[model samples]
Target: MKNVIFAGVGGQGVILASKILMEVAMNAGYDVKESEVHGMAQRGGSVDCNVRYGEKVYSPLIPREEADFIVSLEMLEVLRKLDYLAPAGKLIVNREKVDPAPVQTGAMKYPSDIEEWVGKNVKNAVFVDTEAILKELGTRKALNIVMLGILSKDLEFTGEQWEAAIRSLVKEKFLDMNLKAFTMGREYKETA
Candidate 1:
């Protein structure tokens, strides 16, 4: 079975990214299951999705420490979901920081040592600057797709399959930009 966790704040397209992955897995003939938590998403609160696919999937929720991949669209969300990742799982994280309610309200501080912590704790992690990539792509709305592109590198899906999935899910107006973002993310080389 393949377990993937997609996490981020609201408006980051975390759900859309998971949907694209589900589409890809389903298109490849795998039985896919998914679960989502949209806690205060409209208020920029946390959002996460669990996706599992294989020859047979009986559950939508990924058990603790069993996820093969944790694709986080925000750096802090990586910390929040780190416990779900398998010991040898890969982390594909966008290097963007979105402050939570407490942090925004000055009740708590966002951890400043995320990179250092990840360096010590995560065996395999790829950190991408989705902001820079999106800036170059001329669209800020495709961060999720870019993160998906980075994740596509480790999955078994072909480029064409990914593109097809993106084409199916993304609207026509944003297709070319999102496609470019995916290519850039797939080709991104920086790692942690």
Candidate 2:
């Protein structure tokens, strides 16, 4: 079974990404279960979705230290969800930083060297500058699809399945942009 934890702040399309993943997996003939947490999400708060797939998935919840992949759209969320990554798991993180309310208000401080920390701790952590990519694509809303594109590299599903899922789930107006984002994400290269 593959346990994937998608993490990000509100408005980052974390849920949408998980849905695409679930849809793609189902299309690929895997039994899938998913769970989501949207703690104060409307106000730029944290959001996460747990997805598990295999021959048979019994639960939507992913236990601590049991996730095969933790795909995070924000750097800080990656740090927060690190414990969910199992041994030899891969951590895919976006290099964008979104300061929380506390940090914005000066009541708390954002940690420095987050990428360094993750790199030093996780053996296979892939970091990408998703926001920059989205900006270049002319749509920040496609960030989630871009992330799904990155995650797709490690999965067994074909590009057609992913594109089909995206086409089915995304609205008609935004389909082209999202498709572009997904393609860009697939072509994205990870740097050391």
Candidate 3:
């Protein structure tokens, strides 16, 4: 089974990304299961989704240390969900940081050593600059799709399947931009 966790703050399209992955897996004939938690999403609180797909998936919740992939839309979220990653799991993290309420209110500080910690702990970690990619694409709304694009490179799904999933879930008005973002993400190569 392939277990994936999509995590980020509210308004980051965490749910949409998971949905797209679910669509792709379903189209590929894998039985899929998903679970989501939306905590104060409207106020920019944490949001996460669990997606599992394979020949037969019986549960939606991924146990600790069992996820094959942890796709985090924000750097801080990666630290929050790091425990869920399998020993050999790949971590795809956006190089963007969204301050949580505590930090925003000066009640707490966002961890400054996340990158160092991730580097020391994760065997396979990919950091994507979503902000820069979205800027080049001329839109900031397709960050989720862009992250999915990075993830698409390593998954078993075909390019066509991913496009089809995006076409089906994304509205017509935003479809072109999202498609471009996805392509950019798939072709993205980290410079450092």
* RMSD in Å for all candidates: 1.4, 1.3, 1.4
Model 1 steric clash total? 0
Q: What local lDDT score does residue 147 receive in model 1, on the 0 to 100 scale?
A: 86
Residue 9, candidate 3: C-alpha displacement in angstroms: 0.3
TM-score, every prediction: 0.95, 0.95, 0.95
Candidate 2, residue 186: the lDDT equals: 88
Task: State which candidate, 1 or 2, has the greater TM-score.
Answer: 2
Model 3, 1-192: lDDT tens per residue?
A: 999999988888888899999999999999999998754654678888999999998889999999999999999999889889998999999989888878999999989988888888787897777778887888777898899999898899888999999999999999999899989999888643
lDDT of 1 by residue, 10-113 (tens): 88888888999999999999999999865565568888899999999998999989999999988999988988999889888888898888998999999998
Give per-residue CA lDDT, model 2, range 1-192, as digits (tens): 999999998888888999999999898899999998655655688889999999999988999999999999888998888888999899999888899999999999999989888788789898888768877988778888898889888888888998999999999998999999999898888785
Error of 1 at 41 (Å): 4.6
What stretches of model 2 exceed 4 Å from their correct place? 38-42
